[model samples]
Target: MLIGEVARRSGVSARMLRHYDSLGLVRPTGRTEAGYREYSREDIRRIFHIESLRSLGLSLREVGQALDNPEFAPSELVDDLVERTRERIAGETELLARLRRIGAVGPADWEDVLRIVALLQALGSESVGQRQRAALSSVEDVPVPVEALVEAALNETDPNVAGALRWALARTGDGGLALLAEGLGSPAAEVRKRAVESIARIPNGAATALLQESLTDPDVPVRRSAALALGARGVADAVPTLVEMVVEGTNDVDAADALTVLARDSALAEQIATRLVACLADGTMESSARRRLTQALAEIPGNTASHALADLSHDDDRAVALTATYIAKLRNAQ
Candidate 1:
């Protein structure tokens, strides 16, 4: 097998494979005539074993020892590995228990619960305990446990835990969306902003309806959150709101972004693109809107993208001319 193939099959990167080779763990048996590394069947077999051991959480040194001593007993290493595994499990179990105590799995609870569980597991209780005490020792700050992070996330009140939950959400993969949904009804605007940011982190399924609601929000932060979440989700529903926001608003980066996302459609992306192109092409828009107009047009697809730029090919605006040129180049490349 080729080195790339070996790396793919083993689920190890080429760089890591080379590192393992330097450590004498697994190496190519020979080189091709052109000096490409070649692997024998035996080398492939060893790689598979090494990968398995690594997945089992064995250290590289331990894996090397096991590889060198074919008769080495994994049983001897089982106890330490088991303890490490238990510590991991304990974090997940603790988080799950906390979630069960949360506001009873509301509209925002999705598969991301697993991510929060894993984050708690990865952060471990002991480190958090130390941090909590240190936080308390320095000032009169009430000691907030990690459980409070979830509790605050579940409640629309308690901005402290809500803020901390934002940090927690940042640590986890994309689980913060659920928390964002949970906070949509929060009485506080700051909470709403952080909630929007959390929702922005994942940008899919859960944020859609809420974002639709946010487009009509009384609060600017909430409205911005709605736009950002809609754009991040890349949903067609955001197109109208984005278009309106793009033409009417100032410093509405999130709104413009949402519109641009819609315009990039191969199939459904066109739902957003055509609206933007129409607005710019007819001169219904002012020069102030030209920058965002060009941006949205550029994100659009081939013949459609070219046609959008063609409207501005003879523009009196220098920025519009430059941006249109960029769009023409991109369309030709495609």
Candidate 2:
């Protein structure tokens, strides 16, 4: 086959075939009487081989070595190609994500696009200050997309930066709630915790509803955080988890405080008092747990709490009796 026929059949351009010949990668096996280059069947086969190797990301020199060197091992080269392909894929994926985020912002002009890009870059910056500034500026001027804010919030390790991200997310309204809710089910414990923390800061009924649903999360930290946030919002459903917090001695103080807030309602006060009294009566209740529950009951104004404290004031454990006695005295003084 001649060069044009070779280019037409093999899909390798004539110019590239000539370049290959110049580089001695593939030379014509013969020439016609007019001195035009002529490729034999074996030469065409070598052209296909070069094209095949090039498709696998091999450079021309590498392709030549692969075709000519008898001792050249492909294992190491193949592994290197795999790694390089993975890196390229990762780079492309990141760029695609950046482009999607920019598009989500609905930029009005090139300036808006540039600002959004700069803000996004800053959000992922190595400097904590830049990240924080980006978070703070997200709600001002051209707003950063809530998706970016949520991503930052979930992965952020710095406390101040996380707080800013959550603040920025909250300002975006309830749009990020669904995304944050998905974070609640993440396999990672830290991510779940961050999700709950971010949701708690978002002051909306949707966020509160998500927190209510999170009350039964298998992760104790998630349940505890949700309970506290719900309790502050006066959701009575959080009472049980708050009670558990007091018993487990985890955030027992805040849990007790939340219970106190809930107890301001007359009906909830009686209900809360009854639960506390029952926890006190459980024989398996540890001494420390009993003491925390006793202190928690002190805030309840109903007769149930007073009667429970009065009974506890003379309990067998000296510490329990003393703490209960002090609390009873304070209740009487009120």
Candidate 3:
């Protein structure tokens, strides 16, 4: 259909439709021989999504800015980048405060590694990747859990578990998920759970259908296995099922989060952390969900999270407070 027909069908205005085109927000699929713009079914879908985000208070510039960089890190955009720079510095300080203690300990520094583990357990605000990278960045570093501990980390629901899983993926070459897959047959239920988590985090094409198979399992926990796997992959194929589960499922925080992580259809760990921050303002979520949301948001890089923070700050909700506090703290820390 042409602009008029698309607008009539999609409920978006023709002027707004053209404006979207100029902003690179949407493009015509074809043109009439007369040179008028034309759209296919997919283009109309894009138009509807543009309208929805704009309805959510995103300005044309903000929406376009969002398109320019789908990661939604506030630090990258001029509007919120300044504030984002600040929060990243503070997170580093927090990371280092924990690191200094680990450094004082001798050889294995096992206790310090445990100290960080304990702190992450206690605070629950730390970034899984940050802590994982800290320990794994250079292993003349700290050796908290032996390499063998990877199996145990997966089964645990604690968000910090991702850190341990990241290490196994880095060290194990091609055998990481293969190792996890074997764990499924082990006698321990935790082993099975952990294997599912690791497989979700470091995906293999052959593993997708395996994870999907888990969705219909009788066990509630196992059912969640497929959800998280699909989420970690950020596979668009799972979006419909995920969003449906989002509206109607429980005992599946990890799965729900995996889907939320796919907001822009990306699975990069850094970008996932950035989206977590913006989601803090989600009016649809409960209070506890919002708190966890803030922690994830706080972990984004200074350069990447700044712009996302600014746009989300304008959000007329409670997250603005949490966002502002993080921004101020990070700036002063920097």
Flag regions of model 3 displaced more than 4 Å: 1-149, 154-162, 232-244, 249-334
- For all predictions, the C-alpha RMSD in Å is 24.0, 2.2, 31.7
Candidate 2 has its poorest 10 consecutive residues by lDDT at 138-147
Which stretches of model 1 miss by more than 4 angstroms? 1-147, 150-164, 170-182, 202-204, 248-264, 281-284
lDDT of 2 by residue, 115-153 (tens): 999999999999999999999993669668888899999
TM-scores vs. true structure, each candidate: 0.46, 0.91, 0.32
Which tens-of-lDDT digit does each residue in 193-289 have in candidate 1? 6666555554355556666777776786567656666766776665666676667665456676666566566776565666777777666667778
Better of 2 and 3 by lDDT: 2
Ranking by lDDT: 2, 1, 3
In candidate 2, stretches whose alpha carbon ends up further than 4 angstroms from where it belongs are 72-76
* CA lDDT of every candidate: 0.65, 0.93, 0.58
lDDT of 3 by residue, 1-334 (tens): 8889888888778897888888788999899999999999888877776676666556677766665666776444554544655777898976775555345333345565675466334323355555454434333443433223343455445555555655545554445555566766666666666666666655467577667765655555665656656876766455444434433444335545665566543344445544454455456876555544444444334544555555555555566556646764785487
The lowest-lDDT stretch of 10 consecutive residues in candidate 1 is 135-144
